[model samples]
Target: MNESWMNEVSARLASLAAANPARDFEKNARGLLSSAFARLDLVTREEFDVQSQVLARAREKLAALEARVAELEATAAGRVK
Candidate 1:
């Protein structure tokens, strides 16, 4: 985190705050800070959504495999009896 870069960011933020005078400046500033920190921290919404879909598909496939396994086990049990 370079001091110059921070200064640049601060300048840009000040410009933004000045531009939106009608809004609650402090709240908006906090929100912007939070968003920037979140961006720095990983796990964006798009990536999360993609992983969620993948997990759902995996769960569905697991359910189907479980059902098939149960059927096979039942069939084998019947033959043994």
Candidate 2:
């Protein structure tokens, strides 16, 4: 009976010790990584959307220029013929 009581007391002490902040490795690592990522100059969704729109406009302009070049090339070829 005494041995069983000692085991129960030791288990309770261990449970309390385990609750210390120093033992929270997973939470600490996650917080550290979150802070690291936040330090980076990452864009928000609104900024990404604005950049996407800019890229789309650039693509459209490139397509128009390509079509214009093709038309000019065809006209030049016809003149040569």
Which 10-residue window in model 2 sums to the lowest lDDT? 20-29
Residue lDDT tens for model 1, 20-77:
7746777777877787677566788999999999999999999999999999999999
Instruction: Judging by lDDT against the true structure, name the best candidate.
Output: 1
Question: Candidate 2 residues 21-50, lDDT tens each?
Answer: 655645655665566557666889999999
- Look at candidate 2 and give me any clashing residue pairs: none
lDDT of each: 0.83, 0.74
Off by over 4 Å in 1: 1-41
Best by TM-score: 2
TM-score of decoy 2? 0.57
Task: Please give the TM-score that candidate 1 achieves against the real structure.
Answer: 0.52
Q: Candidate 1, which ten residues in sequence have the lowest lDDT sum?
A: 32-41
